[model samples]
Target: MPTALDRPTERPADARGRVAELRAVRAQAVAGPSARATEAQHAKGKLTARERIELLVDPGSFHEVEQLRRHRATGFGLEAKRPYTDGVITGWGMVEGRTVFVYAHDFRIFGALRKAYGGAYIVMESQSIGADLTYAWPTNETAVMGAEGAANVTFRRQIANAEDPEAARAHMVKEYKSELMHPYYAAERGLVDDVIDPAGTREVLIKSLAMLRTKHADLPPRKHGNQPQ
Candidate 1:
């Protein structure tokens, strides 16, 4: 009375057939619907669903699960057309030798949430932000200058005295864009520990992690009001 798992070992033919079926399903999942659609996706400066996962994860570490699952939607003739994996690739993999779960939607195969209108597309686009900074959105002009508090306030007063309000605003916008968007400002202000070129990113990260392995920090005492410069 062998179990189902044991049966595969006993019956070689059945095991071979099972492996062949698995390979076929994997091929379908990798290729999506057609070669033409996959090529079009590549042309748009975007990697395919599988390629993205592979690049993010460590080499030969990705173990995809639910590769044969299909959507059960029936209302809009979805039952008649059931694409493999339901247009979503999900699995667990390693990034920098650390375990991570990944999920990617196949835009080519199943366009489930189609962007029909322009506004609808914008709304959809806003949902996928990496961080939420809505709390600072309603802050005053001082917020735009980051932590340069007194210096920025003095600069603002000088600009206000020298130029008209509209002209000051234009200058402020230019200054804000220049300082806030670039990496140099943050690096100079000691907000960032270090900044490295894209080519040395991996090497720097590994070294930083090694250095911080035994690092400890002591939080500074909370001070009331501003300190004198």
Candidate 2:
């Protein structure tokens, strides 16, 4: 009598066939809105979260992961209206054939406002998986807000008085100041490794991935809720 460890394991007839079956089941059970579906949802205003990711990554090379996980909440009476993925998409795919994790916020559902569990899930995923590069394009509405001062005052005022000459001048000045301040703030906090021009994004991502891949194999296992301060 052979022990279980001593028994020869039989290979499945078709690995691809099994993968397809699993993928189909995942699609039916867990998959949320597609990049296209999310885009259509936000067509009234702008691109969806998925659309932004597509723009950021190299074409035809994204291999998404955990795409099927749906929101588990039911008691708030909001579950019916909420998307399966809680308006957030998570996955890992190749940026120029190098592995990188992504979590794109879909504003279509709840305006990309992170509900209780959804925000935490993505934060944890990002921390644990350790993306080589993360592209967080929070909606323009949020990003445009000034952190402090008279410049912030000017920005808020300009929105309401777009036709006013004084407002327009103030707005331009405020915008320039904000742009200058943001990079400095980010550097101080170490939120970004470095900022790059929009046109250079793909090349930068490719280079970053190449650099990350050179590190020793077997990265440390993911630790939950380890977000950067």
Best by TM-score: 2
lDDT of 2 by residue, 1-229 (tens): 1122223764346989667755654563233434455556667665555666787676765666655455656686754554455567777666876666777666655555532122442443333356444432222111233334435455656655677756666667666556644544443444444545655666777876687776776855767665343
* CA lDDT for candidate 2: 0.53
Candidate 1 versus the native: TM-score? 0.45
- Relative to the true structure, candidate 2 reaches a TM of 0.48
Q: Give candidate 1 misplaced runs (Cα > 4 Å).
A: 1-13, 112-229
What 10-residue stretch in candidate 2 is worst by lDDT? 136-145
Best by lDDT: 1
lDDT of each: 0.56, 0.53
TM-scores of the models, in the order given? 0.45, 0.48
Clashing pairs in 2: 30-68, 31-68
